[model samples]
Target: MTDLKRVDIYDTTLRDGAQSEDVQFSVEDKLRICRKLDALGVDYIEGGWPGANPKDDAFFARARKELNLSHSRLSAFGSTRRAAARVEEDVVVRGLLSAEVGVITIFGKSWDLHVTQALGISLAQNLELIHDTIRYLKKRVDRVFYDAEHFFDGFAANPDYARQTLEAARDAGADALILCDTNGGSLPSQVGAAVAGLRDLNAVLGIHTHNDSELAVANALAAVEAGCAHVQGTLNGLGERCGNANLISVLPNLILKMGRETSVGEERLPKLSALSRFVNELANRPTQKNQPFVGSSAFAHKGGIHVSAVLKDSRTYEHIRPEQVGNKQRVLVSDQSGRSNLLYKFSELGIELDPKDPRIQTLLEEVKSLELHGYQFDGAEGSLELRARRALGQVPTYFERRGFRVIDERRIREDEDDDRFMGAEGTVKILIGGVMEHIVAEGAGPVDALHNALTLVLSRHYPSLGEIELADYKVRILMGSGSMSGGADAIVRVLIEWNDGERRWGTVGVSDHIIAASYDAMVEALEYKLFLDKVRPV
Candidate 1:
């Protein structure tokens, strides 16, 4: 096979990814994400719709002034024109110009359904929208991309008209014509054939696939093989509906499978998982554990046969090295786990456990018993490792919880004095290396008071702990019926931020009770931070 050619990677995470329901990035968030993307070495960065919203407009305006992008050229996105307006006088066109980006991307209807129904325009007029917009933008910028919206479905419906739409953009001087799976239902074979049909066009062709069919990555790869020169997607596949093609999956597959050279920096590929999690945290969205390439469970294995084979040689069951994508291989201990799995887990935790040792069997039985009680070791490495340390008598806790309580009350006073009420009071007891400490606090609610009292007690002993704060808190109620008898079970996830004049990382905790879960996560967060500080002193 010939060497795979290099293709441009256009990241739309900031623009299209934000279109995912309830996903919004503040200006500071956008700046931080864009800087990370720039460092990742994507060929182009689509900021957002400058004319559509004030936040996006302000982002582009500010990004242009403050960001010093190294490898990527920022692209501003918008539609062509209103059905009746001239391209030169179009509001969207003006908005694109105001963004002051070196590249401008405009979308036009390739699907006759969208043109006739969505835009209420004739097919010929839609062609004009494509041509005129491309022509106008070509004069202003060196890179003008025309997104052929719903190209695959349109081509299947009316091949002649769909080809004509792309011809119009090519004739109008579009640098690259992107075939978008706007509704994202195209098959991989269909994508390959469609791009091949447009191979003779003068303009460079690209593929912009969505994940509605869960085949965006496959479709993109098929398009590349069939002659597309660029791939447009979002990091971690963030976009409307399912999402755009995942550059996280695509980049590695491109380099490793197709032998294509990516613009992404060599070092940055290893940071892909970290970057994906960081963005998900900022968006306040739950991370997909099974997400391809970068998910926590992507490289995780548990079956006895699979674990044994993987231990002998990772290539026995693994397709790619975990570290290649900045993900670590996880060996999960469950009912199906075997001796090999337990041995591997012990090695990972730096624990020495000989298979022949009777204690090994005892420890495995203990783990299995714990698993029966809803203790999941697969997702709680730190907690499991701490347990192992205790079993081996190698662990120490600075303090231990002695007691806790919550009080609630209400009071009413005279009209002249006004009414007053004591809503809640909380108390906590702690024994630090056998030294007892007690604290009390009041709050608007029971959970609030409990957390405050706990923090107050811990703060007195560990003064350095004050530097940490809860950056985000989330509560999820599980399997609760409308009736109070059901007794809703809740789980709280908190992100703790610790600044020691350096950087920070987030840890997670889960429990049935909301307050207990929050406190559990809060304790883990501080412990993890302190452990890091000690091992890697600044």
Candidate 2:
């Protein structure tokens, strides 16, 4: 195999990603992301367009003092000097300089349609804008990159004019001329052909694309194959409209698939999933489970045949070792599961069962029957483990639950404007070692009350229960009121996530009553914790 070619990774998650709807990063958020990107070996971190907003302005001001990036060079994104404005006098250019960064990237009109209709500037004058902005900044900054905005579209509309735009930047000393698929409608072939056409230019080339057509990564890879060395994208593809090309997917494809080297080499590649999740956490966005390379389900196996083959050899089903990108292969248990799935899950729980054990088939039938009644073990592994262990008589009953009572009350105020009061209380009775413990507690809701009441009774019996805390709770109506069941008889499934500071697990319960379902899941959560710690009856 030939030596891998080198490609630079430019991350715009702080800037372009922040433009995503519902994503608003504070100055601190940007600073934290900058440090993470640098740690991940990104070559360039675009620190938003200074002077565009107070947030961006504050970010640069603070980054100068707090952000001490070791590997990545910070670049300020801005546009060229206004249509006829002097490069020395343009506020945007001055903003770029004030950022106190060694590298600067400024965009310019490449599409004649944009020059005429958007900027209302002459074609020749637009070229002058690209040239003058880069030329003036080049003399001041250590490196200046020119983003030829809408380059591909412009090239198709008027090939000569588009070439001139890039020529203007190249002659003006722009270190890298990046082709921007601003509309994100360009196909991979068009992007590859356009970048190929620019091969004659004596300038380094890069590719920046959006995900409007869901082809941003494809177009970027095509351009790389055609000789572009710089790739620009946002983490998790966070950006306006559809989003930008996802660097999470782009980096692995470039290195593992295309055999190209990147600033984020294989050594730092394992941090990709952590970095992806970190950005999503700060962005207040849920992680995309289906995102390639770094998603939860990216390497998950569900089919029995697939899991069976994967157990013998991962390559039978997986395209790449999930560990390459910091992900793990998961075997899901469901109605579609075979003995292979059960064996894998059992082994994961540290349980051993012979393949010929008749109990294995019985357990499989039980799981399928429960799933038919709305028990999904895929996301509730704690519950699945408990059930499997019970079949083997490995789990011991620590306490006997006698009963529980939940009371919810609402008092309407005489004055319509006055707020009504809603309260819930719960009573739990348990028998431990021939002693009965009854406890009552009040909470904001029925589930909370039941949890408080149950834990109050168990704390005296098992002090370890004090360490466990509820992390998350979700409810799903498996059979809705609109189904054949009617409004009064909807079956609901409740999932409760618990954490004892060291580990986390989820338990699930299904019932026609929401409160009953919550109680069932809550009890299982406590039982799983007891089982995990190997606690015995007091």
Candidate 3:
């Protein structure tokens, strides 16, 4: 703890993260993410490489007017002066200045491989670029950071030259010298030792790591322990190649696990999960359910022994309190669940069932039977609750499905083209209040049509369904046992996520027919929504 200092959280999700495949952020997206990072209390936000593209340039132009940043300084990122260009004549340098940002960050080659092979420049000239780039930007910008790219590799190749490159930046009046594991190949020990070698310099030190080795968080923390005060990362580790260090994971590890102080206040750690999910939603990426601190399953306990122990003392199988990071303890029910797990599941469903209740054992056996048919209850608590209530003979049927029909048509246009187009329609009949209600709808597919028709019929009785929205739909095909001789009759598992503004829940269904599976999951999703509205008050 002696090396502990006030840790600065620097987010590069806008710059480096934009390089990730499928991560395409608009100008508005960048501004929104910057605002979120500010609320999270980060000290710096890399807005992007200002001159690299029209989009980044437009972002900076808008950010100058729109970004009233409170906790973080907006930074424009770019490389050092080119091998042949003067610092005064560099296009990127001009872009950085025109960005009107609070900070300027430029990366220069630290590894000899990059200096000699990549840039094809003499070692002396490369050192000059690092120094001149920082010295020139330091005048216009409030703070200038020198990212020593491939620093560990350089230090490993030639320690003296590596130290000289960093010394050149420090001497040229750089505000901070950030050591970057740019290739992300360095181990934590190597990063620590290399960063420790430069700790005595009279400049703020920082570390930026990528997750190619699956050790970006480790390396970043390792650097922190070695006296570096600033760490650069992205939310949910979004970046090129593998990804950057995940601040969502790193901040919790530092503040909660290692007792280190960071700008992300302990009181604000609860927002971590929301922040992570929001970023994922904006990036058009599904949230990783198993991500360390902020994912849905981060604190989910599924094992029987684990649940029993957690019921006694949550610390038994848990590392830290789930609520500490805006997450919750999930007691997942499945064929593997024990009595303690069953009790926890009942509690979640607002049902009271004794652990010794004979119905509990019978329900457990039923879950096992259902799982044998490819039903996985771990993520489908809504469906699990429906099954549990039916086993106890307490299920109050809200609607009885009398009949359903689906029609799919594919047509080949005559004069237009050879493209094939499809249309689907569904008809549903349900008995509610002892009266038959029939509805019809059309959609892009059979499942969508079925869902539309059911909603048309159900919302009349349960108008709260208007608040429900389909957040996600996942389908996994069950192989082996259930599949036909050539995998024709494979059972499909459908997991549907529904959010009702206030909360989100998942429902699961399994059937040999994909449409049937989807319909079952959709039914349970709506039922769970109503159950919550009736039992859990706003």
Candidate 4:
């Protein structure tokens, strides 16, 4: 850090991140994410564009009343008032001033093409909008950041005009001028050249990039390395098209990789993993398990040699300690896994096994055989534990499912002849504690019916079943092989995700029938719960 400069971290998850396809956030969601971002030690939060939409407007209103962000400054973002409109007369500019936030951010077109074509304005007039808008807002707000939209592309096309646009912002008393790769098509070298070209500008410089080219993070770092003072991004890189740069990866890359300082301290770095998951949870999107720093598999080791090396010296396989980011190292067993992988996995689960034991080899071979068929132990730890118990000659079959049936029906409604509805019913009979119990349930579909009936029967013995929920369900047709025709008997793979409010695990099932596949997955899901509570925990 001695040679590195401190960079400001500005977050736009509530604003830019929401631009992603299928992403919608309510006022409460915005406020909650703002609080979390503040807690994560971000320097500036682009809360939203105040006048652009209803949700942004409501968020600013609520935040002005309820948000007391300790570390991050809440910023209201919008365009540079509008083309040719008076700063005082423009409704968008007026709305931004009324937001009662300390900082305001407005993006202005830097590309001559956009200025002349997109806005239908002369290039000369666009500079006035960039300058006058910032100058007007700077008078009312504590700080104003000018986003030089498409700065790199503009610079590449016309470097002189691009520099002139930023010069106008610098002369307008703008606190920071952010260079945006709006199209997400710029390379890291282009970003470096662009940032370097603006080195003489008086305003503090910032970098905002999109991931369309898969180089947003790299380009941001390149700009920072070239002397940009700030970085703008969204959590998990959520945004339009590909997405903006991921702040979760950017912070660490700045602090740990580039040796630069950021508002996010080493102490709060551990919260990065949780922060990533939190934003995805709020967005109702599944976290990418393979995402670089914070994903579930970020620190996971499955190969035997890798697991063995990690056990002896974690640095051999892991670049950074998982605990440094609040993520734990995981050892998973798979068909490709060696004995060392199983040993470490078993040890973690409190199962002692000798590496040289013949049963160890047998267990490994059995796992490989099962994986060849359809079982995936890596995602289903509970199911793996059950197999381990069986190999150890321990049996705790609390209930025996005698049989189950699922019937799906489609019929035309009498009241609405044009409308048709598909309904499913399921009946399950099980021998629990030596008593036969029968249960029936109806659902919107076959899988739902099976889940409903099975959970109902299990709830009688395991009250915790009420707390368990299906977080996600995925079906992948094996080899483009699953047939859609009735009685086609095509093999399909089903992956069911279950969570008990605290922990989550994945279970897999493969069968010719979709309901039967779902049933297999569901039973394994419940059996995992029973094994954890009744066997290992005990």
Per lDDT, the best of the predicted structures is 2
lDDT on C-alpha atoms for all candidate structures: 0.76, 0.85, 0.83, 0.82
The backbone clash count of each candidate, in order, is: 0, 0, 0, 0
Q: How accurate is candidate 2 locally (lDDT)?
A: 0.85
**What is candidate 1's CA lDDT for residue 215?**
95
Deviating ranges (above 4 Å) for candidate 2: 1-4, 334-538
RMSD of 4: 8.1
Worst 10 residues of 3 by lDDT: 334-343
TM-score of 3: 0.65
TM-score of 1: 0.68
* Regions more than 4 Å wrong, model 1: 1-4, 265-267, 334-491, 496-538
lDDT for 12 in candidate 3 is 96
Any runs in candidate 4 off by more than 4 Å, and if so which?
Answer: 1-4, 334-538
Encode model 2's per-residue lDDT on 84-179: one tens digit a residue: 678899999999898999999999999999999999989999989999999899999899988889999999999999999999999999988999
Pairs with backbone N, CA or C atoms under 3 Å apart (clashes), candidate 4: none
Estimate the TM-score for candidate 2: 0.65
Candidates 2 and 4 compared by lDDT, better number: 2
Cα lDDT tens digits for candidate 1, 1-538: 2223878999999999988888877776677678778878899999999889999998998887778888889999999888778878889899999999889999999989888999998999999888888988999998899999999999999999999999999999988889999999999999999888887775689999999999999999999999888999987788999999999889988887788777884546776876787677667676799987788788788898998888788888879886777776778874333455566656755788667977667777877765443344432345556556556655556677787778877655334454475567888887875678888998766656876786777767666665665433444333333233455543334433323434334444545555566566556665654554453212
lDDT of 4 by residue, 53-88 (tens): 887888888788778889999999888868757989
After TM-score superposition, the amount by which residue 501's alpha carbon in candidate 3 deviates from its true location, in angstroms, is 23
